[model samples]
Target: MTQPQDPQRSWPRFQTRKPRILLLTSQFFLLGEIRAACERLGVEHVLLDLQAKEMGLDDFVRTILGALTTFRPDFVLTVNHLGVDREGVLLQILEALDLPLASWFVDNPHLILPAYPRTHADKTLLFTWDADNIEPLRDMGYPNAEWLPLGTDVHRFAPGASGRPDWDADVSFVGNSMVAKVLGRYKAAAPGDELAAKIREIADAFGPADEPSAARFMLGRFPELRDAFLELESPARMLAFETLLTWQSTLDYRLDCVKRLLPFRPMIVGDKGWKDLLAEEENWRLHPEVSYYDELPGLYPRSKVNFNCTSLQMKGAVNQRVFDVPACGAFLITDRRRQMDRLFEPGSEVVTYADPEQIPELVERYLADPAARKAVAEAAQKRVLAEHTYDHRLEALMRTMRLTFEPAAQS
Candidate 1:
């Protein structure tokens, strides 16, 4: 296959003899993605369901040793959390094992630092491009650390024919605005400012701002944004409701940062806690969240353009939607990220807005020019399928480990 430029020095190639994979994850949520990737690569994979069994530190270590003995995996893949206490048992096992290992750090690595082996692991995969993480990995003596953005299963999020004569607006967003606690973590106003700028840009693009700039903008050009925000009594009510529902869905503050942002859409499928939250919102057009791998490819195509917004921690990283939506050959309009241009050509493969303000106009432009939208989506789908598929990732990982062991094999 083609070599991945820069992020990692080269792509990992697949081997005829599938590598045995041992996946250790604290959350049950990821068990699906891990299984799918392994199945596609034909790798022998064993998943230790820590959440289901309520497995913790010492138990996890004993389990890893047992798996290594039984499965004889060539590599280990751990989720963000490594171990429970100091001199973590998992960390110890990794140090002793001759096999290579790596982690997909989907969470903020800084918050969970010190759980990782300071001087072990062949490589570490990051979700965002944070320069700060590099120094720590270097200090810890890891051989390699690089950003591998989060992705969605394209087959699961595929497009459906989402045309309904009675749909509310030409464009819509299923998300909330909760800024307080987000600021507490990053101490940055990018999220708030970006949201406001998106609104303003849409207004200016449509027409001159009047006394009620939002209302005037909506009344004239983007009636959708005005409709979405104005439906709530006030901004405070919107913010309060968002924070409250999020608390119900995610018991911990950590989960709230990511899970809470999802808009109150009837179609979103998640935990039972999520169903309870949706039940409270009578207006949402709720549907069961899909379970199978093939369902996603059917879902994303239903909308003209899907909306993606980022949390404070994920500002630098494109969410899974960035990859998944395009992979389905569905048109996507996403928030701006500095590195986005390098991955997919801007206004070509994917459409990006300078801020939320530009969303309406951008959406309008895409709707008006179906040819352009179709061309971009098709191009993106082709590019992502060629370079960014999970199989591509599996190949890259295997190739690296093979190279790491090549010298040893010769000796």
Candidate 2:
């Protein structure tokens, strides 16, 4: 009989033994998914919850170092650099110890990644959810920038799940009303009158354009704004302005998408921001936020059609809803994203609308055709189960890490 091939010969191992990972936990929704993925892969992990205790720099360093010494993990991982400090102490320590650190960004890296000072560490591997960001990240001098899209937990978000009747609806959207919060911040920290007016004007002109186009339009219209943004005087001012611009665009786009579905009487599950934003819309039903682990699993599968409006911050990337909705065996009508075509078969496994004008029509068509909706949902679920689960993601991540850090581990 022929000897069986070693699995390690096909796939590189991170270490001689099962790789131990130190997971820096935070309030981010993906924390649980990562933990579960590690469990399913039989990888040993230690969770260091940052929010559980308040720690100064010294305490933080001590705690992390203690964990490093005790757990002796091959790597330290976190979602979007949640537990990392702005001073880069954690990164410096990891670098000194020659430990591999992986930070997977599910959100816009431009906004969050810059906050970390030691982003260019050689041992640091930065994974972005958006493939469009890979070039930008490389341009930013990140040596190990990779495109790693988000995945769903198939077991948690599956079909025929029992959920509260209140959560069930013909059309449902689960996201935040970010406009109010973002605009409120901008208003409080408004630049001078001239700059503020220019900001408003540029924002008004930034309708329905992709990120690059919007940025170019704003720059073309108001060149001084770019100069002012780049000015070193009060960096916080520029950051706040950029945040406002991004959020304003997102809020406007999301509101427009939701408004298109007003005819469908969509149920919006999110924060009070939605209630305040659509206060006059009688057709929209707003529910309070649901816990990701406890409630969202049931809610996603229960809804007939789960809607996803990708945030403007993520232009080419699909949001978590794109994967989660399908994994739940529910039909998803998400705004068309360039990356969606690569992830799912458009109109078959998943549905997409390029314009807000098409949203209402698509919703109507899907609502009227239950068989079509069911077929697409089932197909999407199959695709998700087969290829887009966290297990697959974890395996890919490990492979990348091994190739980057331990190429010799491969036979």
Candidate 3:
């Protein structure tokens, strides 16, 4: 193994044009933001949109090798887990090239089953709910891993820009419920085939529902409900009980998840499972209403209080809306996480609810003190723009990879 050298004295300085950067991501949906960030940094970027490419292993490696030869980028960035299974090809070629590679992963890499590989890049940037996971990456050999929170693109997801009217209700949310079951029927006939068919049916019907997709669907189905859902009618207390009920799952677990739903107006959004779980309850607005990304920024701000609850596996990891909604200038009351304060100034910039029961009063208090809520949102936005953006994180990556790009004198 190559021994680690002292950190670079200073980053390479280029004249006229910015650094030539190559970003290889198979996820096409992320291409726009990656390109935008590169543009903002004045970096000349060649995006190998893996979604658009159609090539075999040999062809893929050859193409990447050729791109490296022609582009001669100072840096190459990729999502930690390539959507394409054929990642070995890309990694082998990039490693051979001695390129300054940076991996940006959005999820809590620590708990993901069959963990995303970490061999190719110099640094792995990840987001987490509990900030403590930073150490494990180093323990696992990714000494360069850093905690970078997910950032919402302020340009698109803003409340004022959504063109939707101000919502009338007190609190609202706009994100999908995640599937978090690992299956535990060791004795009773498994229901394996039934489960598979049900999943297949939903996949076929909804076409792989994501937050943006769900938001768009809602906008199309109930345009007027946008405001009502965005500014939901507040429940009896400050906190609302919310859950993404995996409809087909048994009531025991779903109800356990639901116990926290009603107190805060428990606005559940996602698939038909949530509806079935609620079974025509007066508090639950079952089907997803706010579907598009562009609409989220405005939608979150309309509510006096917005609750963000993550699925079990992701409970310790901060969701995109943790930053997105608040960055949109909304006061968010989120489930407690240890890492939250490290990312945002607690009490001042963001607020966390330790118990579901606390939400209602917290909401009432924050709403009553409009100026304090606005102050908190403003501070959170400032912090997000400064430290949590893709550009900011990219700059951090550049710093981490400075050793790779530094000149002999700087080294």
Q: TM-score of each candidate?
A: 0.62, 0.89, 0.70
What TM-score would candidate 2 get against the native? 0.89
- Which run of 10 residues does model 2 get worst, by summed lDDT? 1-10
Q: Against the true structure, candidate 2 has what lDDT?
A: 0.79
- By lDDT, the candidates rank as 2, 3, 1
- Model with the higher TM-score, candidate 1 or 2: 2
Report per-prediction Cα RMSD to one decimal: 13.4, 6.8, 13.2
Error of 2 at 370 (Å): 0.4
lDDT of 2 by residue, 1-411 (tens): 222223233232265556778999656548888898999889899998888466776777778777877777778889888888777777767765667898899888887765678543678899999998887777777878998998888888776666898987999999888957686758655666666666556765665555533445567777877765555255456556666777777787888889888998989998888877898889989888888767887898777888989887788888888888888778888889888888899878988898888998899998999999999988988999998999998888877887788747534
Predict model 1's lDDT versus the native: 0.53
RMSD of 3: 13.2
Clashes within 3 Å, all models in order: 26, 0, 23
Score each candidate by Cα lDDT.
Answer: 0.53, 0.79, 0.55
lDDT of 2 at 284: 83
Residues 1-411, candidate 3: write the lDDT tens digits.
222222332123332235677777767665577688878888788987667556676666556666767777776766645533433555555555555566665644542312334555453334332444566656666656566556667666554755345453466644443332322211121333433334333323332233212223344554653554344333211011111112222233234434455655654545555554466566656535565565565567667777666543333456777778766777787776656766888888888776656666777687689888788888888888777776776666566556444554245
